[model samples]
Target: MAKAKSLKAGDKVEWETSQGKTTGTVKKKLTSPTKIKSHKVAATKENPEYLVETEKSKKLAAHKPDALKKK
Candidate 1:
């Protein structure tokens, strides 16, 4: 598997979802994996995480660093 990403709050990012390409802001960084929309996220202290809220939908989610791109 590829390495996870490191992100900070207030970062702009893009991600692919059922709704298509979506943009959002990083809300929080998680040290451990958490459940978002029934999906299990694998997060660790070394890799860390970012909890993002979708710009259009206003939905909150957790995503791996590799799953997101800085924009």
Candidate 2:
């Protein structure tokens, strides 16, 4: 098993999407539950959400830390 990473803003990460493996930069770290880009996300307790901006399109989306991979 692998350990999870605590990502911060500006960190580079990759995630799997419909478009394949997409790379992005961390834009924001959510401390409280919030909605991002119409996606209802919970950032609390054991799960926290991160706002990531895609490197290619510069699109911002909210995702769980587990969805991100350090690059």
Candidate 1: segments with Cα more than 4 A from true spot: 1-4, 35-40
Task: Quote the positional error of residue 38 for candidate 2 in Å.
Answer: 2.4
Separately for all candidates shown, the number of backbone clashes (residues 3 or more apart, or on different chains) is 0, 0
> What would the TM-scores of all predictions be?
0.74, 0.82
Which residue pairs show backbone clashes in model 1? none
List model 2 lDDT by residue over 2-71, tens digit each: 2227888998888899979998898878878887668777788477788899998989888887888888
Q: Residue by residue across 1-71, what tens digits does model 1's lDDT show? A: 22336667898889888868889999989988788879887888887778999998889988878888888
Error of model 1, residue 51, in angstroms: 0.4
Q: What is candidate 2's CA lDDT for residue 9?
A: 90
Best by lDDT: 1
On TM-score, the leading prediction is: 2
Cα lDDT over the full model 1: 0.82
Q: Which residue pairs in candidate 2 collide?
A: none
